[model samples]
Target: MKRQIITFATLIAVVMGVGFSGCTKLTDFEDTNVNPYASTIPVTQNLLTGALRWLPATVNSDVGAIYAQHIGEVQYTDASRFLGINFAYDDFYRGPLLNLQKIIDFNSNPETAPTVVGGGSNANQLAVARILKAYFFFHITNRWGDVPYSEALQQSDNLTPKFDRQQDIYTDLFKELKEAVDQFDSGAPVEGDIFLNGNPDRWKKFANSLRLIMALRLSKADPATGKVEFMDAKSDGVIMTDAESFRYQHLAETANQNAWYARYLTRFDFAISEPFLDYLKSVNDPRIPALADKPTDGNANYVGMKFGLANTTGIGNNSISYIGSGLREQDSPELIISAAHVLFTLAEGEARGWNAAGTPDQVAAAQYYVEGIRESMKQFGTYDATSFAAYIAQPEVAYTPADAIRKISYQRWIALYLNGYEAWMEWRRTGFPILDPGPSPLSIDGEIPRRQAYTTLERDLNLGNYNAVLQSQGPDEVNTRIWIDKP
Candidate 1:
């Protein structure tokens, strides 16, 4: 009787399974048949690659380049015109930042700790995540001062986080970098790292180098504090050569191609700017051919388009020079920070009597400054000893105490070509090689933007906090200076 009853129930279950397939919820059955490969939580190692890939794409593109005058828009030139910008901070919060936060969460959780640290130490993985978090936050905060820092990424719990002052944010970033470096465990190497290849020493150098960058940014606002941070980071050992520079080695595949090549090459929507081209041409800069291509109109040399022009009017498609193959090729590397940048930073510190190498003299500044230029040249694969010798001997390029700052700033500018955000930041700080974007129909006060305006999305979605930040920081305008830019 029991066997017969079990057979009858089995038959009923089979009949119901077929008969109620359309009406019953599939997920009810799926609850008991979950895929083993699928999990609610992500594997920590898998989260890092996406963040690293996206960082360069964000850093090396669009508004920053336009502001720095590395590339001019061939079509609509509103962005290059110093018009009001609506930078969507929402994308950042939802994207790379989320991924980085995941890595931190997975490694820090005791329940998921072993799985997350499968090939690495819990401390090392967490440290790497923290360092990257500091980096992304640094970029975000630098772009828009007094952003939602402390309480951001809270998701549903804290949708309305208060904007943290840029000063406080900087302080926190310094702390993160210091702590992350200190926490690196050589015994348990980091795995699945695309940036430093799990090398703790390099990561340590990177942390110190980033601190140097932050320190120099405070030069105008707080010289005393800036000097202290600069000296401390340099003493801890910052990036010293091209071999140690932070860069992304892009692959030739469609998915892993360089961002610029993907954006500009096939479309031909961007061209070298007149200011940049003229500057290089004026100096007989050897890097010109490496930086830009000859015009397709048979000019046999580079010719720049006027930046922020209304349209590509009075110019044929073939007249303007495209970004050169070396930089705009599929496999071109995206440089995050170069040895040149560090050397130049140190050179600037030395010139200003901050905690940098050598005496606070012109000779000391010149030494680092010249090496920065050399390293930059080598970085571009354009270094010829004979040419470099003649190039530096020029009175304009040669260093003198009266022109020390200008030379350093200008060379730093040159080395930072295509690395637009850094160039724009330096321009904001030092105001050297004074750029002229000229008049534009869309410009406010006929001046280049001091800062990007908060996005419309922020105003719409997080209006209360957005309004608070606007009221406290300044008007929602690009002309307003951030804390770092102010006295």
Candidate 2:
């Protein structure tokens, strides 16, 4: 599949001269399928469409779910056990990043800029591509500390790019985000945006919201820098309401349906994890029924399978609760970021005395916390004013100044239901609502992994640079903490 996408991209470059400079000679004139009038330049819309496909798909259904304890595998539990996990980074560079880079390249050219952009101005199209590139790089660096940044994607200039430090990468990400958002022009609206429908203002909000999240990641290690970035991001405008949430609408067709639905249709092999179920049940969370299924063994309560279980020994499809209908629907929306997340991040920032759209106060923090919860429910179609009021009135859910962080972190964990990678990353950063991997023989050092191991290909093909990172970033093991995960 990846090969096919790359091949198609190559054909586009050959026929239209889209990705890079210079036109290709039509040596294969015998090919009747080639369009004679095809412009010898790539269209920005096509590249934009191809690039957006990877964003939600990678986040929503990746292996990070197992690590986050959002779901337990009924079979093939090796991933849950944190054994022999090595990440492949090649697809990302060759796929979405490749397309996005092509868009930027075509639009950056003075001669081809006007025709390549189609509906949008060259500046707006370039800004959109730059913003997406920053996001893609952010996602990559967050997972595996230092990576190829400055020298990456320069096939001609440098193939084996040296790994940039995480600190340096974060600095560049902030700069890229800010510059990209500022570059949006009213000359013409962006074309072929799958998430925001070409709204540049919404794109600005998404960028600021992403910066807000990224800034908070440095709270523990570098509080001063975190506070500055958080305040700056908040002032720039962020996603503060459900209406502005970043999401991708899935199609009803089998070819382009929700990734989760496609996976479930092929096999019934996952269940809500025991820890996840217990937390929601403990709080009598109103969102539970919408999040997980009711047990099928004549039990009225939801029963999740234990996390880290070696195999599907005692578990049966009818005995355990699977994910609910909201997630499995054919045309379900893939939520990339939500108002709930933004609110929760604001709540945390306020608690830490960082300016986050409101004055820092215990009362303000509590209000934001409650609103975050409500937003999560509203976004998932489970909001009920009366029930939500009752839920918040509980002693456990009530907002108190002393237990503010705990309450915020715990609810944030619950709010991040299907976004397992972010949930796990948050858990690593905050260490709140402590998770337990139930008694399983397949434990790796009796704990969840801090980071995924580097790809075997990187270790073999890029041995020198790979070893340098390993030496600086600790052993090439899952438990080796990333740079941001400082104690």
RMSD (Å) of each candidate, 1 decimal: 8.3, 4.2
lDDT of 1 by residue, 99-142 (tens): 78878888888888877666478889888888888988888777
Cα lDDT listed for each candidate: 0.81, 0.81
lDDT of 1 at 293: 88
Q: Write the per-residue lDDT of candidate 2 for residues 1-487, one digit (tens) a residue.
A: 1222335555665766443344255454346466878877677787898889888755785477777888888877877777655787777887788888878888888887877767488888888888898888888877888887787776545646778888888888899899999999878887888867888998899899999999999977677888899999999898877877888888999866887888888797788888889989998999988889887789887998787777677677888899887887888987888889999999988988897444458877888899999999988889999999999999999988888888898888878788888888898899887887556634357678887777787776667888888788888777788888878
State the displacement of the C-alpha of residue 338, model 2, in Å, after optimal TM-score superposition.
0.2
Error of 2 at 322 (Å): 0.3
Q: Which stretches in model 1 have alpha-carbon errors above 4 Å?
A: 1-33, 36-41, 356-359
